[model samples]
Target: MKVRIGVGHVPVGAHDPAAGLAELADELEAHRVDSVWLSDLASAPHTVDPLIGLAYIAGRTRRLKLGTGVLILPGRDPAVVAMQLAGLAALAPGRVLPTFGIRPAQPADRPAYAVPPGRHAEVFEEALTVVRALLSRPNVTHHGEFFHLDEVSIAPLPAKPLDLWLSGRLPAALDRVGRLADGWLGSNITSGEAEACRVRIERAAADAGREIEPDHYGTYLTVVLDDADERAVGALLDGIRRRRPDGADPRTLVCRGWAAAREEMRRFVDAGLTKFVVRPAAPVTSRRDFLDQFVAELGPMET
Candidate 1:
């Protein structure tokens, strides 16, 4: 398998976010990191809007692939989303990687991504359909329960069609990836779980009479430096616990050092994951220290 590694959005604590993001983008480009992913959190004050942040990064760097780790799709207008992606594709060409999710990450923020009651899944599917149509077709007429588009067209379409990737670990979500998406970028799951999910996706695609590309399975891996400060480690523990309250030990899920991270990456690669987004478990005091380590260690592992 061809392994491609990328950086996830690292929190810019106590720094000017605009400047921090610019510097981070520049450094990633300088170091030749494969890509940079922005998380989508609609209500979080600290989080940057993925599309806008990506556009900014696109301007700052020439070779970096820009991604929305998982943009929420049910609440947004698909046509508008398509237009934004088309613009980005026009600007960045083959570097726009969009992975969409059915809902926001947090329950409290779910209301902010408002869709019809009990119809979030349906709305997401419909919205994706509309977005795909608008991106690839010159004139699209889609009539669904949630969306109605008549002879709509988005100009400046991508030179090549954008590959629509999806996120989620549930069985239904895995099946949907086979039926609709061109790739999968899952999160917060073990290598064993990811392997199983990949199997389901392949089975679904076969049943759908469609074939997904072999090298499109990817996942996020959060890691911490072994010598990281106590506060940083504590924050990382708390964040993972809150995000996953299902009693899984944080140590089992998070890599404690560079060696551990490499071993985990190897396991994931053996399990059929060819793409990775490695995020810091917590905010670091020195971007250079973290990035330098990233380059010295995981960077060489890229195929």
Candidate 2:
């Protein structure tokens, strides 16, 4: 399988969205990165909408593929998303890949965007099916538990079908990827965990009477880099600490030094992951530096 390398969104905690994205696009184009992705955080302050941000970047850069890391599917109506995506693809032909995922909505965000506690995955599947059909056909009518469309068609169709990816951490989600998604994207998972997840997805595909070829499996890793000693690295580590999972230490999850980080990526690649999206742990000042170091270490492998 071919290995693909991509740069993901810088955590929106401390950066100015417009300036940060502008700089990021320039850096990615300079390094010849494969694809550029942005995150969708429903309630985060200063976070740009992923689709709008990608459209802005699309106009600025020529060759880089644009994608959403994972758009929280349950947050918006599928028909609305389909229209938005179709329009974006019309503007940037064959360049946008829409990645969708099911996320547990926060308590504070529930009133604004509500899905029953256990029903997000089901809703996501139904929504994706509706959207995919509408994008492909001229006039489509569908009735599903979550969505209903009658003779709907998306105009200015894309040159090719969009590459759809699913992201999650549950076995059920892996099964959904096998049956519905064109690729899988994971977060904060170890290499061993990734391999196990891939196995489950392949098994689910087989069980569903689908053939599994070279699946596009991608993982996100937190990386910290400093030209000096660990103190500079520690600052970046602190940023990650703020976002650590409920019971885990941030230090345990980050790849610190350049050498160690490269080895960590190697392990994931060896485990059958064909793509990687690296999330830098540093602030804006250090983000470019870490990106440069990462490209120097990993770019040749992709080439």
TM-score of 2: 0.88
For each candidate in the order shown, give its overall lDDT on alpha carbons: 0.88, 0.76
Minimum summed lDDT over a 10-residue window in model 1 is located at 10-19
Model 1 agreement with the true structure over 84-109: per-residue lDDT tens digits: 99999888889999999998877777
Task: Name the top TM-score candidate.
Answer: 1
**If scored against the real structure, what TM-score would every candidate get?**
0.95, 0.88
| Cα deviation of 251, candidate 2, in Å | 3.8
* Tens-digit per-residue lDDT, 112-154, candidate 2: 5567677877887888898788777788899988778888888
* Sliding window of 10 residues with minimal summed lDDT for model 2: 104-113
Off by over 4 Å in 1: 14-16, 242-246
